[model samples]
Target: MSSSLEVVIAGGGSPGHVYPGLAIADALRARLPNVSILFAGTGRPLERHLVRAAGYNHMALPAKPAPHNPLEAVRFITDNALGFMAAAWMLREQHTSLVIGLGGYASASTVRAAVGRGIPTVLLEQNATTGRTTKWLSGMVESVCTGFKEVTPYLSPVAEVVHTGTPARPRFLKQYQQWQQQGEVVRRSREPRIVVLGGSGGAQTLNKHMPDVVSRLSEELKDWRVVHQTGEGQLQCTEDRYPSDTSQILTVSYIDELASLLFETDIVVCRAGGTTLAELALAGVPAVVVPFPDASENHQMANAEVYREAGACVVVDEWAAGDRLTDELTSKIRELAADHQRREDMSRAMRGLAHPDAADAIASRCCEILCGTDMRVAA
Candidate 1:
């Protein structure tokens, strides 16, 4: 008889992968009271600290992205494969029941090992396109879930794809509640408020330009509030580096209340990470998406283009992020703020794109699969 009573999830190093993985784990636990959850990650701050703080056990492994050079590729594989072997060994000994790959180097080792063991597995892809790590391991898993149905055409026909929507931090929902309580006074107020996020570790591109942009705001726009999330280390730099007054700007390494910021926001200028896009959609907020240019396969750019085509966001190429970006943003903000009908239409479009129940859906599906419930039953 199978003895594993635990679900093992592999993802870490970046908040992009870690946050969703945590949400899935959190959801699974809420549904399945009997099963335990474990994580395999590279021990990045968000992964290790946040997961642990959430009261879950984390099994750290050494894994890095596969190399571009043929010579470095061998070294990378050897390193990651060994880490995989270790994670597999851990799973083997722990009596793991289900294995999940959330896509990233942290999962590289665990996924390889789990598939070889014939473990029932679920892999989640959050972008409109699958990453190379996920694509390579797609067929090995029993099912592949995606955030957007749009990613379906890119995957292998043999891979069973389900549209699960993207799993976001619980704060997204919590913040929505607060927004409802604030009523029309704050909601309909003409004060222009912009929230800017630089993604997990912070966007170097945003860090450099945001300071300048904050500096250039005119006295007429003095009442405008800019909230900038620059990730951890940049908080101090943001605090002292920029000269903007507290009333005009608030800069932090991270904001625990991200959802609150969303509801209060008139506009969002953020990296086009899948989760950010999903959150913007869920919150019905218009945005300016500046994708990370060096993102693998230019996936961020692709993600941004999807929303742009839908008229949900404006795309700003990373190459042109400084100086005039402030002018460009000011122009767009005024345009979006003045054209009430246009903003409303785009907000409705954004709301249409949200999957508020995605986290619950993925968690429930994985639990059902792990609990010996047959997939033949409808979801």
Candidate 2:
């Protein structure tokens, strides 16, 4: 083990990318008592706030998303150039030995700089499909740590691929187990509960359509309770959209403690983000996964398909919302709500996919890399 270990984890656009880095940092701390890890984020407000809340040292990078238009494309090149220069200077100033990229446009600069300077680098790909940033950096990084085995086929042939299932924080595991211990009491309750999440920042489409979904199910859900997380500025709209006198529904802008909410939830209607999916699997909560259609390469759909194929979830396309989507969603929800055996079966399947030791596994490999051990996963 290196007496001096310093790692810079760069990535951020959402909690999905950031949390995995934090989990790896947590795992690193456990294995290397003196390991020093810092988060290098995109300087986005959400990323800074989350990194601060996690109580880790953070440095922001002036990184921007790859541009779609010509005007923005010029800006993208300039920003990447500047971000890369800044990252290179930071690595030298901080005496960083390893740089780990979690995924996102924000991660591009630091990873590019690290590889350019010949610093060992690794990337953690969270989706079943390769993210754009991961794909761009695949040929340069020393190793590509993936969350799904399905992703291996898509990565660069020369890259060292390690299948390290996404890490779910230990708190989720502990809280879920406690809830399971009280399962009999929970099952005895006549009231049914479901949670609607649109990612950490909230999903506008889900917020727009959820009230309708609940209204149609209101009569059948007379004994039900709902927790809806509407993204900022949309909470009031969600509240207004709910059917009049809907005492069964609780709508909020965001939830800081989702593990607690999942404790009482029967089913989850949410986006199929990698981190969210990992939490759902750990909690063994059946879900109605609505992948964000615009996700790069439709990775969320690929992620949802993993569980859908395993019979652990129901996948609903975002495009189907205008057509029979609501009807489809309503029917699925009704069926799951009514069929206790089916939900239990789905729960079992979800649990079967959980990798509780994912963080430890990835950490061991990270330590191995730091010690100049084999970085490649055995064939």
Candidate 3:
């Protein structure tokens, strides 16, 4: 690859989509000192902040999620057309050599523009099932890199399908090494910590139900420290509900020190987003994954199932409520927290599932394509 290679990494909607692109961009930068990355995304405030904070140029597109209502659907179409135009102009203006779609509606326009211009395009699908945009563009792209092996069979027969696993940020690897160094001292501690993650945007069901679950198991969890990463939307309400006297329960709108949090956590209760799962695997943390039922094609459930099969985590549906939810979740957490060996076993299983070098692997492939190695993925 050229030292001055320029590429557009496109995706948004949530931190799940954006972070992986950032990770890949970082990997590429590390590999090629002069590589330039321009992040293309919808003008989401969070996405904008994340990209700029990471020290990358960002191009905002007029893309939006597909709307259900007929009127809104028309707007979506028009917005995407404008988005395609914007992306085309960016590619030409920036002299981008490659376009990478990170699996979201925002990436669709950029990928289409690149392909239309006969420029190279690659897609990173960070789920067990292919995202709608990725699936639609599969046949036209140079390659489709997947987070799970299950995705390979579902992709276009002609497209190159590479199982690169999800690209976890370098922070996870750094924290994992630190945890390993202090593993004995930390594991020997009888009091276990539990961290609840509601994804980047937060999960409403988790926000509404977790406080009660904690309250009901307060006695059992008395010796345990619990930290809940409530999304910004539920921050104030969720915080007010916790008892002021107990230092055992802490609630925050977001998690800034996620790697450290995961390093100390014995059990994680979170949504089954690809990026979240990858971090958990890297940290070797046991989890109770609650799949978002409305997620496209119920992909989260499929993602969780992969971990459950490998003994990495337990899966609980979001719809489970009251006693059904509380009883099952409490039992699962209690069993793991009480039994050090069992948590350790789950941790080993999780580490086995992780691909710590996935970002580098994808970056290497991108370099191969850019440097004019056969663009077609090897069979």
The number of the candidate with the highest lDDT is 3
Give per-residue CA lDDT, model 1, range 312-336, as digits (tens). Answer: 9888876675657667765666576
TM-score of each: 0.89, 0.93, 0.93
Candidate 3: minimum summed lDDT over ten consecutive residues — where?
Answer: 370-379
lDDT, each prediction: 0.77, 0.83, 0.84
Candidate 3 structure, TM-score to reference: 0.93
RMSD of each candidate?
3.2, 3.2, 3.2
Q: Which 10-residue window in model 2 sums to the lowest lDDT? A: 370-379
> In model 3, what lDDT does residue 220 have?
80
**What root-mean-square deviation over C-alphas does model 1 reach?**
3.2
Clashing pairs for model 1 are 84-109
Residue-level lDDT of model 2, residues 70-95, one tens digit each, is 99988899988898999999999988
Candidate 3 on 1-379: residue-level lDDT in tens? Answer: 4456788998887888988899999887776667789999987899999999999988899997869789899899899999999999999998988899998788889999999998898899888986555666888888898999998766777888888998987788787778767864665565688888998677777777778778877888898889998887889988777667789998988998898778778899999989999999988899988898878878899999999999999888756644487677767776776777888888989989988888988988897888755543322
Q: After superposing candidate 3, which stretches have Cα over 4 Å from the reference?
A: 1-4, 180-184, 320-323, 373-379
How many clashes show up in model 2?
0
Model 2: how far is 316 from its true place, Å? 0.7
